[model samples]
Target: MTYVDGFVLPVPEGKIDAYRQMAESAGKIWMEHGALQYKECVLEDAKPEMPEDAPETCKITPFGKLAGTKDGETVIFAFIVYKSREHRDEVNKKVMADPRMQEACDENNMPFDPSRMAYGGFKALVDL
Candidate 1:
């Protein structure tokens, strides 16, 4: 089963192009480091749910709401897939050590708030 890292964050509308550029570079690095797949998606049409329609198990927060997006902000959903958890760890270590990764982080101003980004690792339960 593949292991995955997921991310959700808010990016300023005006910075979408910059964010895409950054993501492209970063995705390339991850792929080179052994990630099977890397994808970044911007929100197209996300809306908050009505009170009555909300799920009882937990808050039915949409991606926009989960990101706490502002008037001119949009949400981004990204993921990286690896062969396994160990492979993911190995790939991440190499990705983080790469000079290009450091250069990108140091030279470019990120388009989104790093503190507001949500991230997690997941073990695939089912794949079809």
Candidate 2:
């Protein structure tokens, strides 16, 4: 089964470019280390249009809310795909060991608050 590392983080609105640049670098590294796919997307429409007749109870949490974005912040949703859990671990190990990744982790150079980021590893349930 395919495995995925998914993460959502809030980036300050003014720092979007910095975040993009960082994500681009990380994506390249992940792909070079055998990630099947790497994607980083910013939130566009938080209030998505729903069926006119849909119940209010069916409303889903918006990305901004899910990511706990603040007034000056927005959300970034990213994922890296691999062949399996074992493959993901292998790729991540290589990625983390890379000098570029090490530098990004040092000195809290990230464009967003690391403590507020949400992350998880998921096993494929449905692939179509």
Candidate 3:
């Protein structure tokens, strides 16, 4: 079983390289702090394909729509996995305390708007 932290956010298309650099740096820090895995993925083909039998309210919304992504922006989905909730807490505590993490969060250096980022912790229901 694994506990994970997930994130979804919008980033301008022109800023994708900058965002990738930031995510790469942050991912390394998370791994160094004992996270089992760290991944960041940008949306490629996000068209929604709803089942005919599904309710109207159940229509699938693409990541871009869900994030209110602008014409020149795209969505990024990211996650960090840990052995368990306790392990996730321990690793995150260290990651947050690291100087590199602080450097990454410096207002002048951040590649994206922190306020627009959606983040949450999840318990893995099925991992195969």
Better of 1 and 3 by TM-score: 3
Q: List the residue pairs that clash in candidate 1.
A: none
* Model 3 CA deviation exceeding 4 Å by range: 50-58
Candidate 3 residue pairs in clash (backbone atoms < 3 Å): none
Model 1 worst lDDT window (10 residues) = 47-56
The residue-by-residue lDDT of candidate 1 on 3-119, one tens digit each, is 999999999999999999999999999999999999999998687556785678756668887789999999999999999999999999999999989887774577888888999
Q: In order, how many clashes per candidate?
A: 0, 0, 0
* Candidate ranking (lDDT, best to worst): 3, 2, 1
Report lDDT (Cα) of residue 79, candidate 3.
95
List CA RMSD, all candidates: 2.7, 1.1, 1.8
| Position 16, candidate 1: lDDT | 97
> TM-scores across all candidates?
0.88, 0.95, 0.91
lDDT of 2 at 44: 90
